[model samples]
Target: MFELIGIPPQALFGQLLLGLINGSFYALLSLGLAVIFGMLNVINFAHGALYMLGAFVAWFLLQYLGLGYWWALVLSPVAVGAVGIVIEKTMLQRLYKLDHLYGLLFTFGLALILEGIFKHFYGVSGQSYTTPDLFKGGTNLGFMFLPYYRGWVVVLSIAVCAATWYAIEKTRLGSYLRAATENPRLVQSFGINVPVMITLTYGFGVALAGLAGVMAAPIYSVNPLMGSNLIIVVFAVVVIGGMGSIFGAVVSGYLLGLLEGLTKVFMPEAANIVVFVIMVVVLLLRPAGLFGRER
Candidate 1:
């Protein structure tokens, strides 16, 4: 019976829910980017490729090992994180002291190679991961029908994002990470193996991206290009949130998603570019980003 600007509540709320779901993915992926860039100072352009790898890894577990979603949820990230560790130790570390451009270029090239390999085999038709048995139903919300899996996604993603924020902003290990990034030699003097710590931090960040990928498998068609398609927007999110600002990344992701959802209902023509438009505005006003500190 109630409508805002002549638009039905169901349509508006549905778009909001959709925005929240997308924001969850954006938060997860951008959180990883924030961590890696914040702690390691590496501009990881391969993040999307790594995300794509996570989805494929989940698919592989399901198709080849009969592992199912739950197992893939755990294993895919671990696998991707391990790959991240290798990347850090073998290659990424070497460029730490160099220009940020180098790291970006190296990772970007790596992403291309990875995407090419997968595209060659998969042919980009895409694969689908079925919703788990426990999450295949829908709930009537009086106004809108909400799918169980979509609700699960929103809750779990918020939990994960909250947990990550707490870990980095409140805990002792988080302090150490912050310290090491600020002055590795000082932290090393405290007997912390800074290199190892940095390595693990990068791994953990990559794992977050992988976790996002696995969660997305059932909702979006699993394809080699999926990560690439979504990643540019994620990068925009990180920039708007403030590069390397953990809290900024989380908040910006959800905020942008909601804004995007609103745009879809009010002005469908601009929905696609709304996020970027916001990014441009944010940059013009505060180049450092909404939550980023000026160095």
Candidate 2:
């Protein structure tokens, strides 16, 4: 019953939770995009379509093979990553040396194709995935009742984000990726297959998108159009975070999510515009993004 700026703590915290959950999706999806753009120089507009594909992949497994969430966790990313590999080889590889805009356009077209196909079959009515048995309960936290699944989402998302950050920021392979992006010729001279490196990097990024799709399967209604709608907001997050900085994407994604949550409690009308407002402010303050250097 405690009042927080004229709103109850329950309302505030609930909004906060919603914001964090949405932010998790933003972080995961944007991180993948940031990686591809920064390192591979590919503007992957098809990412959201690929994310939708991941969710569908999970649904397919459940329906036809009787696979559970646990199995989908391991399998969906692999499946999607394989598809990414095909895309890179068939289409994206040809555009590496051309204008970056071409990459964006090609991928955009690909997104439309994918969305069109799914829309044709599924018709966008939305499908649901039930939470697993282990994650279906709620916990009384003394102040409020917290659903186990929501908590699991928050905790697992943080862990995945952290692990991804560590892998790219702290490891040797990450060093090569950074180096290769800055100077592919130099990295190739060092005997690393730079082309393969680019392909794998793109795949890994797509795999991250797949992981997000699987994670989101149970929480949000599965629908063909889900990724398309969320992708725009995520793009705004990328712009705010700086497309070149992975950590920036992750941190800003979560921060904005929390900010959106706070807005929902005190000024519901402001929730949708708050992120863009912040993005505009950030751009005015630092045109290169919060963590990026001006080019």
Which clashing pairs does model 2 show? none
lDDT of 2 by residue, 1-295 (tens): 4563687776667777778888888999999999998888888898998899888899889989999889998899999999999999988999988999999999999989998999999888877888889999888875567878888877877898898889888999989999999999999999999899899989988988888888888988778897898888788898899976899989988988899888877788988889899999999998989887777
- The C-alpha local distance difference test score for the whole of candidate 2 amounts to 0.87
lDDT of each: 0.93, 0.87
What TM value does model 1 have? 0.97
Candidate 1 lDDT over 249-287, as tens digits, reads 999999999999899888899987999999999999999
How far off is model 1, as Cα RMSD? Answer: 1.4
Give the worst 10-residue stretch by lDDT in candidate 2. Answer: 1-10
The clash count for each model shown is 0, 0
What would the TM-scores of all predictions be? 0.97, 0.96
Best by lDDT: 1
Model 1 misplaced regions, further than 4 Å? 1-5
